[model samples]
Target: MTQHILGGCLCGAVRYRLTERPYNSGLCHCETCRRTGSAPALPWAGIACAAFAITQGAPVAYRSSARVVRSFCGTCGSPLTYFHADKPDKIDVMTCSLDDAEAFPPTEHVWVSEKLAWDVLGDGLPAYATGERET
Candidate 1:
């Protein structure tokens, strides 16, 4: 999407390219997302798994759930991909990790209700206070 943006982990040990646009690009306030992102909200978007590839190193994986596996660079510890056991066909990418991050603006925000008061965040996108909200 946005003329095919590309990105990788901080160490360049992990790399990826995306030809299709990402859907649901916004902040997620769910507890699981917050832990992995180590942020008040995780900015992410869904993309077809087929459109993504690890062009570089073999990153390590951390299981967030029995059905979900999160990928990150073993060397740099940069959060990378979110693969789901149930879905099997798509993955969620961390938007801030993109090499060409300027290509997309968050269209919506999700899980606003779970956010801690100290972590104030804002964007023009639609905001929701719960995990059920779609970005």
Candidate 2:
């Protein structure tokens, strides 16, 4: 059976679907992610752009950085996806937006160097100081 993962914005205005299981599932502690989601960390799952499709309302896009573009639901301000120019074929979807978020737990923590000083990371997932993990 073909796998389909569905998700939508808080107001249900924006909806999306993934045709396959995503990869690079992780928690991002980057300052941009923290501020964008208004949370301590943002959980994300990476997938090929071809595997993702917006099935509902269009999301408002914002150029978060010179090389990055982020989208969200204009009606409810729910962060949706993050795209980087460097990775033209891939995009990161906010895991929390998934209908079954519990099914995709983060595998590691990235950008931990930018994490809040008081934010305690007791999950014990491998923490990386930066986005480039030593492979």
Candidate 3:
């Protein structure tokens, strides 16, 4: 049996499916992520661009920076995916957008140093000050 990652926008205007499990998924609390997501950290799900596809309404784009961009629903305004223009073959999805978000839990926390004043990240996942783990 194959487990497909399925989900859509809040207003049901958009939907998508992925046949493969995320190669890597985690929570990111970097300043960029915090501001773009408007949350302490955005939970991400990664699937090969080839394995990811949207079968419904189109998602909007926000050029977060020169290196990164975000996609979301124009109707519901739900943050959806992140990707680097230079790295076009893959995307970091917002796990919350998945119909069954419980299928994926964060494996790690990125950018703990800039988390937030009142954000309590207590899931026991090893916290990283940046992308790499501290020695």
Candidate models: Cα lDDT each: 0.80, 0.94, 0.86
Q: lDDT per residue, candidate 3, 74-103, as tens digits?
A: 987888889987778988889999998888
In candidate 3, the residue pairs with backbone N, CA or C atoms under 3 Å apart (3 or more residues apart, or in different chains) clash, namely none
Residue 110's C-alpha lDDT in candidate 1? 77
Model 3 RMSD, rounded to 1 decimal: 1.7
Scored by TM-score, the top model is: 2
lDDT of 1 at 25: 74
Tell me the TM-score of each prediction against the true structure: 0.84, 0.97, 0.89
In what order do the candidates fall by lDDT, top score first?
2, 3, 1
lDDT of 1 by residue, 1-135 (tens): 466668888889888888788866777777888888787777777888988877778879999888889998889888888888877988988888898666665777778787777866655567877745654
Model 1: lDDT to the true structure: 0.80
Residue 120, model 2: lDDT of: 94
Give one digit per residue, the lDDT tens place, for model 2 in 58-79: 9999999999999999999999
Q: How close is candidate 1 to the true structure, as a TM-score?
A: 0.84
RMSD of each: 2.5, 0.9, 1.7
lDDT of 3: 0.86
